[model samples]
Target: MTESNDGIDRRSAAPMYDQLRRLIVEHIENDRLQPGDPLPGEHRLCDQYGVSRTVVRQALGQLEHEGLIERVKGKGTFVARPRTAESLVHTLVGLYEEVERRGGHVHSDILRHERITADAEVARALELDEGAPVVVLERLRHVDGDAWSLSTTWMPEDVGTHSFDVDLREASLYRLLAEQGIVATHGVRSAEATVATHEQAQLLGLTAGAALLRLRSVSRDESGRPIEFFVAYHRGDRSRFEFQLDADSSRGELIRIP
Candidate 1:
């Protein structure tokens, strides 16, 4: 709504959609709109806010992205249910175990999990000579039905990928590796906050400039031979990770993975 010749804010000068989003979110915060309360109809909202239907609709979309609102097909937008803390543990567990234990469901969409010749980066990370063949595994991990993360793991080809032919939706890669006499006895992992790259954003279903958690690790056997090097990018909003100074043990000497 705008006022002429008076000391009133001009709705046209400022984006009406942003203004409407602010107004609606404020209502929810101040108790004017409760969780189950129905939002006004699209046409009605336009009339009430003195804006076009386009502006009103776009505003609703913004609220939905912020996780403050949800829209049903036949119904309308409603407040999103509050999210609880998923365990923020920093453990060297299999991706499968970690997701399940954190109260999240896990599934994988196989991208590629096969033996391949290692590049300089992969060979160095896996502690193998450059250009050596390696077992490289790539998969997209889903948690709570959303694509929570994407991972690529590299291992020396001498270890063989045959035993790690992971069932995309069922088996665990780490578990498979252990069963094949390569128990990741202990290893090191590094994590950092980062912005998703163009390629990473596409694979993770994130906006081109979204924030992400890049977790890289190198798991090894008792002999300290680097067996697997992994890199995973997790959605910043829907995922969390934790780090501990040391986890109640000092049997293995700690070293940097990256």
Candidate 2:
């Protein structure tokens, strides 16, 4: 393997292991490493990157957690084969953006997009008075031509209806919101496993009573004002979610969802 001193930058604000992990991903992306190909052993990586074994382990652990690489018993880590399912970290980007970033062909079929009076949940989520105007967006997310998820988003009508005029099937909602000077800086996310309803299954191309993963989120701006409320139902057979927790953060507790 070719070694370059440019791989790690001591002056960078990013952690050393993160940089190393990116370097490895770059190698895979650049065709230097093919799927199922063995990655350099920990000692070799340590020597090549001029980092300690702990750093190497951290990097490897992250790569494995992301499904980019895998470790077999008594065998070194290797590049993982391409996956048919979709996954994303708990980030602010929309589902379409995430799927496209992972090299999947993604598009949305807009089911409902109109101004409506806020229901109790929508009003509470957006901190608006009951029956206030809100823009409701219902969509079926297609990944690789499969209807993978059903999502509904609600935003204050004044903020969403007046500004959102683009073709949502061809645009990202978050991007459109940003162009209008509204950006979500943080969000609260929670997920649960539930069986698909008959209507949901019909929309998602799954059978009724099939397992589903439901994600609910409330996004807010820097001023702590709620910007959007989103709920998504994902096909359990075709989707997953991954989260990275800081080992140093006291609030970083890992919750396993069945």
Candidate 3:
């Protein structure tokens, strides 16, 4: 390995492992290291940073946990390729936004996009009359060329009909809605474990019956009117969810997405 003159500063108050983690992330963000590029081994990192092996390992472990790097069993660690964006369930954000925030490429394959009569469940969720017009959009979202999510969204006719004219391959549904003066301000979401169906498995490149994380949410406008009912299927191994709660606030208990 080439000598690294940018060694950690022992005088800094920050922990060495944290400093190392920052350095690695900086390298990634700066494009000094490309995706799939192998990272220097533990020994090399130790020597380059003038730190102990334990410190090097700890830093690597943290990076792995953060999805910034991946370790191959026999091969060395490499800059991690972007998988599914780690969805924070409590946040009323869309998948496209999450992927873009992480500097990952996102594209969608529109499986179904058309106006349809609202089914009983969809009508109930949107507080619309049964058999009323509703727009349905089904897409398979990809992250860095890998299938990440299979999403199905239903919206009231007035809101969803606009989607038919929009180019969903490149446009975000939420963004399109916002353009039409429909903004989602709040949402109620739930997540559960599920088994993939044959269709889902084929689309996501997994075997049927594979474990998946299924998320359902109902988003509302500023007037508290439900605007959309959304469902997403995420690969259990590729995505993780995190939430931050205030101890003094309501529902203070911590919950993690398994």
- Candidate 1 lDDT tens digits, 72-127: 54577667554434333356687687767767678888787677888888888878
Question: Judged by lDDT relative to the true structure, which candidate is superior, 2 or 3?
Answer: 3
Cα RMSD, each candidate:
6.7, 13.6, 8.8
Q: List the candidates' TM-scores in order.
A: 0.67, 0.64, 0.66
Q: Arrange candidates, best TM-score first.
A: 1, 3, 2
- How good is model 1 by TM-score? 0.67
Give the count of colliding residue pairs in each prediction. 0, 0, 0
lDDT (C-alpha, whole model) for all candidates: 0.71, 0.81, 0.82
Over 100-199, each residue of candidate 2 has an lDDT whose tens digit, in order, gives: 7878777889999988999888998899999999999999988877778899999998678744568888678888888788999997777788988989
Model 2 spans with C-alpha error above 4 angstroms: 1-89, 162-164, 250-258
- Model 3, 1-258: lDDT tens digits are 437837588889999999988887877777678768988888888878789999888998888766778765457888976545465477888888888888877799999888899878898889999999888999999877878889999998888878877778876788888989999998788888898898998898766775688998899999999999988999764787876668766563444532
> Which of the two, 1 or 3, has more lDDT?
3
Q: How accurate is candidate 3 locally (lDDT)?
A: 0.82
